[model samples]
Target: MPKMGFKKLFFFKPSPPPLSVSNNTFSDSLMEENIETARSVITECESQSPPLFTNTRQQAKQYLHAVITLQSTMQYLVERDSSSQKLVKAQFLMQIAMKRLQTEFYRILAENRDCLDPESVSGISSTDHQSSVSDYDDDFPEDDFQFAGDSFSTVAMADLKAIAECMVSAGYSKECVKIYILTRKSIVDEALYHLGVERFSFSQLQKMEWEVLETKIKYWLNAVRVATGTLFPGERALCDFIFGSPEKKIAESCFAEICREGAMSLFGFPENVAKCKKTSEKMFRTLDLYEAISDNWQHIESIFSFESTTSIRSQAVASQVRLGEAVRTMLMDFESAIQKESSKIPVPGGGIHPLTRYVMNYIAFLADYSNALADIVADWPKNPLPESYFQSPDRDGNNRSPEVVERFAWLILVLLCKLDAKAELYKDVALSYLFLANNMQYVVVKVRNSNLGFLLGDDWLTKHEAKVKEYVSKYERFGWSKVLALLPENPPAEMAMEQAKAIFQSFNAAVEETCRAQSSWVVSDPKLRDEIKVWIASKLVQRYWEYYEKYRGGLESVIRFSPDKLGNYLYEIVLFRAEESGSVSSHSASPPHRFKRS
Candidate 1:
């Protein structure tokens, strides 16, 4: 047992050397009641050479309570003391007693923090313990709460933070704040290092760094919440601490670094299209992370004022801008990568290269931006899409002629043109029309299926539809004109059997040439294909029927023109167009025995 010598020290009061009548007041003695018991404890320490050893932890805690109460008593006395010398002595003694009991109280807590029945060791009532310790011993207690090497340091910190809570209850707000700052810094640094933010270098990225970064960011933000709430204990104060000057600066700096990394990851995507495809995928993963930030953005704004000095807008608003930049960067990279790929295969090719389909599809998936596209598409009208919407040369207000309502739509129009031009490059003109049809049809279908269609209005779809029809008409003119030319003019009713056979063979040859040439062509729009099919079937079926009826029997059985095959040939001819033969459903099964001379 150590000697607690201060007991006697207070009793052996020095002779009153100083007298100041001007400052002496009745209140001084009144305060003595609050501090007298604490002063009397020193008298016991003086009579004993050393304090008796406590038999159990409970006794030690009683001694700790005596010491702690003595500190508060001394502080109360010091504030009332009129003499400067008395004040200094009182303050010094209070510090010593506080330091000693703090060590003692905490040591007991550390030794018995586990197992059971902690109050018995501390001698603190359950109510006192709740106010002193339980505040920080929250559910799902953090394991790595403090120093990793110390087995019980985490619990010790919890206990310490709980003690801080007691101080807060005692109205030591500044002291509580200091504790909060220290705890917050420690937790954040530990989280950042554990999640690898310490080595978060952007230019030289390691795989999965973003994942680690995101995890750490969540931990850090939550730590800030818990920390600020503990220290300030109100809605407004949390906002000021989280989004205010120094702390907000720290969060923004971290976010800025993250954005730098994200930009490097997305904007500086590899030149190769395959790599870009993977990059596009990786870029979208950031979307979720960004969405989390966006959610925070919304969450914080609602809780925090925007116009107030402490508002998040003053600092964290950059998060919104950074999110926008990431989105724009991704969109720009997508277009550039596809355009770069387009350069690989020159425009004006007859058939779209498979890579072209792949690149086009990449944009198709990005159609999640469909609403944005709708906004852009709405700007351009169905009639005369202007080359540019220029502002008033004549000083008119907002006078952009044919004002480009939607820039994104304009971008899509460019892509459409690029697709058209690429299809044009195909030497097989028929195949080129098919490529255009497929690309155009895919876009129209996607827009209609998504909300983008409404914003674009019906005109956009109608115009593109007309464009598709024009392309189909061009295809028919290019691919089937020769076959159409073989529509037999009204056969001379008296024509010789040999002449009729020769004309039928010519007609059969023309039909065979057309079918063989276009057997594999594809038109993706079912309606567009049906239109072309009807056109070809009308030109061939009715004319061939007339010609067959006019001449089938005129070709005598002796000529062996194989009258048995005419119906079958006619059926096959009308049911054509390689994509689908069944749209031409009206072909008669049998040729009429129209051998009577018409």
Candidate 2:
């Protein structure tokens, strides 16, 4: 484990008073005097020695010492007179001490805020609002890490721990947690204000998040654990303070903020998984949240502490029989959002957006943890299977998983279905076919190349490859039919000139339309792309070649368009790259033209 930034502050159990002292009789006057001074102890803690309480650490140490002393005196008196008026006095003073710490910490930190982090004083706002000022451009100095000059941390950490100890020692677990919550809010708000958290870059946000979690929060949790976990059966415990009844006690130790906005909300996690997935910029945000939360959970798990990070990671996961309910909740929303957009995603002019590959890439990412995803589906309510299972695969020989579908596999299948459906909307059939071919080919290759193949079981790629062929076959039909028109069965020899003119017109139209349109189209794979260009070229040139020779009788007859010009026409129609459009000239060579990958 990496060393935490904060100095280690261990919690210790104070030994009980000697038996001789316990048996000592207390006069009513002395007992009354001790109870009267119990409240005054808090005042004397600061008043008696002003210098001792100057800094935060000093104030906390003395503050805790006074609280403990008052409690002991109060308890001793209460034992002799179980319903003493002074005991009530002692209780009120303890509450006063708690209130003072809470109020003073806020004020002291607020006043000295500039000394801790000047930038934060400006950008950090009230907890209710998130600051939009970005701290991204600032170069954080290494001095920020050493924290040698930090007057606030010393006071906050020490006093916070002291108060928690005093509370736990007095059997106030609820107050202990409340103290922790208040201390956390103060520390987090200070850091956030300083870091301009609301507008932090990803790198800055992650750096500070880990620092706060592993150090400050870690210390607070450890202190509470030591206070609560160390008590004997008769002694009061931290957990006891939290949940008094056995039935009411929960295994989880979630904080207020975690129960509300979640642990990552402070780190700028988007409002929801569905929201993050839809905004292309937030594409990887949920995955990042999962990873961060997962790691923090491990950090806590190494010990026995369960806290905010657990809830953050676990919020999406459902319990009950559906252990994977949380995972399904996050992923299912993503599936819905992506599928909705896939059909609507316009094929840009002749080019495909990188988004076409995102679905499969994300699937590959999901596939990395296929076992986890599979577990979720394995436990879903075993109602009758949805109709999606029986629906014939959309032209892709791929069918739904016959067994409980792994989340990743199910999502990928949905994407494939969407891709196929989207392809049908392209106004240009050849372009639509190319888009389908590109996406299908990409999905197949990605699955075969990654562990996605393992999760999806056998024949995932083979089935999608069959879909690619279906697309290719459709493309060939749409593209080649135009070229086939160039050789219109038989030309009447009776009206030779008129027949020749009609063939030339049809030939020009087909050549220009097919070439110009296809030249701009994209095919994602190198091998498949080359195969497509060759396939189209072969069909076009073979028939054109025969017509050119028979009609050319070598230009003895007046032909308006030259046979040599066919090469120029072919060259212009096959523009490959956007960059090559400026320089490429028409073909002067023979007509078995195979184009390069665009």
Candidate 3:
């Protein structure tokens, strides 16, 4: 067996008798007395029916100390008399005590497995330096390892650390380490099994159906969270507490070997998922996987810090890269779907198109993961858009990163461009304008209400708001231009009453036709819709009312609407509530007609 270093003898600090010995004879007598006391302690523990640790912890500590003291005396005898029978007897006693201590160590670990489980150990503060074996008392006091309370886990961990230090110190490290590795490894493996982590080949994952694969990805997400946040760290702490003293490499080496297989299986799943078929719906799940890995990366690096576990670290990083590629590719496909939208059918009532709804919904969902996406697409270049096209560069209070801001801006621009193409399918120029306004309003509202507003910034919202207003203005101008044309430019100094009647009759027919034709047109944004109605009333109603009053004496018999009735007509027709209200008949509700015989 390889020699266990002297540094492992944590409790073997022996101070000699403080009193001055008169001669070598007196000192020799003192040494023999100390050896006799140690031999007595060892013999009593061996003769007992119960194990030393289980019977009484103080006795266990005494037996350990006695064994260590015997080993030291044997070394002294070897130097003094290389062939002494006394040396043989001391060696025999030392081996017998070591064998007993080894059995006690194994029993403590096996019997207290639950006490040392990961979830319980993880609750112990990492900053609690008092819990380390370095603080152990040489005399093994009852309260030496008790802090908050004499908790079961606290005592068990303390006992494990004390035995580990003693066994390593006695040069029986090989046996002690073997028992520890086997027992702790079982716990780690079982914990991973309950977490639902399973190793899979690339072909198996790639060939699996998405429904099955998605369930596995969900399991992986939860597993990665618990494993990194609790399980792995707790195991690492336990290993360090047991074997970290005077040799940190042992802790790192044991930890690397113990957690290696489980961690690789845990992290390797994402890379295989990223390699599977890419779909629009799968993008968020892939991002979820990426975010999970990204979130726990710091703890992963610390837990598997050993050079031997470098492959696990590399596998995690590779999964991130591949997941990133998957997201980027899905984004490209979404953009392509927008560009490839071949529908020539104009949406009825000039309402929101399906393409508009799908793209906006997709983009809004993507906005929720803007920060994670910023890292994924850090190297993926943005589609080149004109500087003037997307002008919200200043994100002072914005939480989203610039790359994601620009990326979302480009995607929205693509959707708008697609909507612009679909608008051309409308035969009515006025309805086309209303189509643009409705879809633009939908996009602006989606951005304003979701995380996209914070990412795109107020400037982007203001720009799109301006576009919606422009569409509303064009729709009003084209839609009601003919009706407005029916009114005279000025109040005429008319001579004949017949011409005056003709003007009033033409005005009445034109207003009714305009209201009836536009009753079917739709505006989805309530605020914008009401604004359009008010603007139209201000322009058309006030002008037409003045014309009606001027011609009332000659044309009142033909007059069909009063100014108040005209305003109500505009409201009902614009809202398409004329049929619901049963008020679409010719203006029978107008005030009494007054025609003067001039």
Q: For model 1, how does the per-residue alpha-carbon lDDT over 512-597 read when each residue is reduced to its tens digit?
A: 66666665455545665566666776666666777666776745543322333443443345433443332322322121111111
Off by over 4 Å in 3: 1-43, 77-95, 123-150, 392-400, 553-557, 573-598
Which residue pairs in candidate 2 have backbone atoms (N, alpha carbon, C) closer than 3 angstroms, thus clashing? Answer: 56-155, 57-155, 120-193, 120-194, 228-238, 316-326, 317-326, 318-326
lDDT for predicted candidate 2 compared with the true structure: 0.47
Q: What's the CA error at residue 275 for candidate 1, in Å?
A: 19
**Which prediction has the highest TM-score against the true structure?**
3
User: What TM-score goes with each of the models?
Assistant: 0.56, 0.43, 0.84
Give the number of the best model, judged by lDDT: 3
What TM-score number comes out for model 2?
0.43
Which residue pairs does candidate 1 place in steric collision?
7-42, 7-43, 348-424, 348-425, 348-426, 349-425, 349-426, 350-425, 350-426, 376-406
Residue-wise lDDT of candidate 3 within 375-447, one digit each (tens)?
8777876578777678647556656677888889999998888889889998989889988998999999999
The segments of candidate 1 whose C-alpha lies over 4 angstroms from its true place after superposition are 1-32, 38-93, 100-178, 188-199, 206-292, 301-316, 319-359, 370-405, 488-494, 524-539, 554-598
The per-model lDDT (C-alpha) reads 0.43, 0.47, 0.76
